[model samples]
Target chain A: MRKREPRVILSFPATVDAMSMESYSAAHGVPGRLIPLPTAISAGCGMCWCAPITDREAVERAARDAGLRVSGVHEMML
Target chain B: MIYLDNAATTLHKPPQVIEAVAEAMRSSGNPARGAHGSSLQASRTVYGARAKIAALFHCPRPDHVVFTSNVTEALNTAINGLIRPGDHVITTDLEHNSVLRPLYRLAAERDVALDFVPADRRGNLDYAMFSQLMRPNTRAIVCTHASNLTGNLVDLRQVSAAARAGGALLIVDAAQTAGCLPIDMEALGIDVLCFTGHKGLMGPQGTGGLCVRAGVEIAPLKVGGTGVQSYSPTQPAEYPTRLEAGTLNAHGIAGLSAAVDYLNEIGIPAIHEKETALMRRFLRGVRDIPGVTVYGDFSGDRAAIVALNIRDYDSGEVSDALAQDYGIATRPGAHCAPRMHRALGTEQQGAVRFSFSWYNTEAETDQAIRAVRELAEE
Candidate 1:
């Protein structure tokens, strides 16, 4: 079994942005999943991207390469 | 602007809802499926949420609550999983499309027999008629806790009694009533309870689940890797993992947990009292307005939803006017209960709905009253 660890969580300001991140990352082979923004991060609600810590460089590269604006990113155990 | 479309979804969630969701993302990993530290923490967070939901609904076991994408999926899972071919299922006219659409599809595809108990002109169901509809193959009785259109509440005790007597399981769609109304799963004999987090629970959209009582099993609607028993091609046969076959909506659950915590802190009784009071005030203000016809029972049994129409205006027109001119947001048309509207004789011109929530204020109710009165006069 692959060991899983909570990585830095990134939240976009809009639903479309988060969705775009998903599309961009998948096309470029970036590793992450779009999930509803975790509650501990904010009481206000929307979706965000949960990437594995090991894939941080690839995700960031994908975001930059795809010309997607990055949102707030915080490292958490989740 | 006043927001009275809570039946569709609650507008503003509690502050903790956001905080909890963020915290979950920061601190937790995939729950109950791993042995690593982060995974264990994630598992604990999920279990804590399950306990919170169990406490809220008074479920005997926390494991009984299974998460889904939304109430629609939950309803589909329960209805489709339980009813075999040629089985009979009893439902009512007050159901939202989430319940009705899936059952209708099952009836056509799986050959299940479906009987709908007609509601009164005001959208109240007659339990006597429902009792008579029970047949030998009646496997389940599925009904909404409150009508999404009219906000009329069914007598669950009566329905539970009837289902129990007929040897049928009772499924209640608590999308509108879970956080706003008091419900005890064990005491009420509800074998299956479906709830949406976005509505009364005040969480974000895309979060909902079903609470399965002991001895009830719902097949997985979609099969995939549940991060457990990955070697096996078939779905896991555990309580929640059996049905939750995919990457779980951990973020939604995190927000849902916060929403549930907010409700618990304020208390359901207090929230209900606050909302029902607003309902009464709005009812009183709109009842005597000329050309305004209200739907649903005015007797306070319903939740915060109310449907009404201006005498000569189309529901859409009134809704647009309310939004554009009055700055009040209200839902117009069938409200996803087309059959209920048909039963209420409002199918031709669906009524406008004003659904309230705990965050709604007395001043907002007054604003809605003034707006409707102005629209009615015009």
Candidate 2:
């Protein structure tokens, strides 16, 4: 197994919305995938878009271009 | 079995619909909950379903289409969310329990004044009577787009005009007619359109929703987490989240979207033509059977459902005989529209309904007609 590292995640208001974000990004060829909201980040019903820390700014810009809502974006260790 | 209880639930779903549901479950995740590819795919599936539903219903805002477990739940949300204590509302005999029971509870608990515009024995509404019943404080007019018991279509334009003049919101239960009939909510001046996916839309069970017109504010029936606003103590005040609480039946909606896609490809008028032609064939076959009686005003547009009776036979007995003896399946009794049954004087014997769909063939309709003929002769 490979060593793990903290990755950037974008939490959303609702699960459907998080999925919407992912869809827009993929359509625009942006780099990211949706994952279950990290439990350490206050237990809630939400999903986040995760990508490389290096891609954070690019992903944020993609989200803005696609007009998707972002709850919060954070980088935390796995 | 020659299934004819479509008013209860459509048994024959298009193959694409069945596959789409399975595909969604296999490929998607709890959308909006993740930043991963699977979750993103799920989110897209949900959005696709919402957009398709909105387009089909001609709802201006796709976000206003809120998913519920079924039409019953959607109707409850519409009724309880909109009607307040001391408010006046109107309905009619041509409604399923989904529409009537909520109003009944609201009338009992909230002291909401309720009035029903009576229907003639033929399941025909006197639109003029609706004019007489309108009042200044009437908050909503909740009724069915088509009668589940008799297959009669209401003149929604006339009903909406009444609702508009009286300053009441028109909430239509489209359970019986959503897929078969064309429902342009804005063009019809409808405030709230509630529907189930299984009946006309041809999706699986547990899929239904409401299309809220832009400015019509219906209160949220349930409040909880809406993935986006986790910090908020109450449900978020947006379109879908304001009404939708908890993980939606994403799997079922996936199926609903596929069904909508199929409907769009085939066109509603083609589906209507096929189903109605079958209905006419069955009706003509059942005619001249000595003791057979048909109910409802078959004068204009209607669903593919036909309610009938064979002289003095218990409706259940007739349905059972058809099922066991003829390998035909049908629904008997009041069909959850007890008031309509009463109006048709089917209080004691009830009625046997033979509903049709695109999957049904002319041969099956003929078989059912023959079965009823045999039963009538007995």
Candidate 3:
């Protein structure tokens, strides 16, 4: 048996920015996955990136290096 | 104008929805795929939202719910992913363009046969008609849970039972009923449930998804990078990642999650009771008006969407007057369901639609009734 949890999530100002972050992170070998922004954060519907909490810095750096705009970052037990 | 066309997109979202989007934008970082503190928080937020939606739909597994831009995209994903060329699909006349257009396109291009089960004059689906329409080539039956134009709720249980008997998958478009009605995906036997977040869900626009049943494999509509499978060129074969490609609408999801929470806290049954009561009131007021013709069954289970027309008054004219003169906003015309209007014998004239939500008060319905009464007199 195995267990799973979502540790890190990123929010973007615009859908394109979030999309660019996904592209940049993937191209640069960052660890995370794009998901619909969670309800805990908002009741509106949109997408966000989710990953293990530990990979935050590398992914952020990669997003910045790729010229992708970052909105907000959070750590939660999911 | 006083907003009344909620079926198109709900106006005035709950305060929590706006706050959640802002907070996510301000605090959370890239989720799931990231490893930092902010990303971890963001991931948790997304998971929490998924759980909320799963709870809303009574889905056993949140992972089965895959996000999309809107119900159209969700419907497209389910229809295109599941039906191959030469496969048969059974649908209904009450379907919106979202469901009709894609199925039509697939029929023309992919050589699939689409059978439409016609709705009766009252916008009710005849299950017997649906059973007769089934064929060996019928691999799936996609139907809207409610009519967007007339607010007629289809008997999903009957349809699902038919699908089960025929060994076909049942896909339901829950766009109008997801938040306004009580829907249990597992209990309904619905193989795929497509819904939008902006309407009854109380979320902002640009949020929708498909709740796919376990063991059902639908091909990905778009393929790119899923943040996972950095090594694989093709899309990954997982529940959500398999379907979700490219960057998701994080801000929208945050808002949607908040909307779902608001609905949950308020309780869907309560919302349903409130909206339906208002609908009944509105219908009763207009039912006896000499010049007004109301569509759909007033006695059965349905959403709050009401379609009507004043005698000798064009639908668009009434809608425009409702907006310009009375400051009451409503949707006019075919309501993106031309076939539905045609079936109801109102295609040429269309109809003025007043779709209600929890935000609408009894006073608003009274005002709408008065406005219609005035229009009828004119």
* Top candidate, metric DockQ: 2
**Better structure of 1 and 2 per lDDT:** 2
lDDT of 1 at B297: 87
Docking class of 2: acceptable
- Sort candidate 1 into its docking category: incorrect
lDDT of 1 by residue, A1-78 (tens): 546577867765433345456666766777887665666776544456788887877777776775554557777777
Off by over 4 Å in 2: A1-78
In order, candidate lDDTs are 0.83, 0.86, 0.84
Candidate 1 error regions (>4 Å): A1-78
Residue B37 displacement in candidate 2 (angstroms): 2.6
TM per candidate, chain B: 0.97, 0.99, 0.98
Write the number of the candidate with greater DockQ, choosing between 2 and 3: 2
The predicted structure with the larger DockQ, 1 or 3, is 3
* Clash count for each candidate, listed in order shown: 21, 22, 67
Query: On residues B155-175, what C-alpha lDDT tens digit does candidate 3 reach at each position?
Result: 999999889888899999999
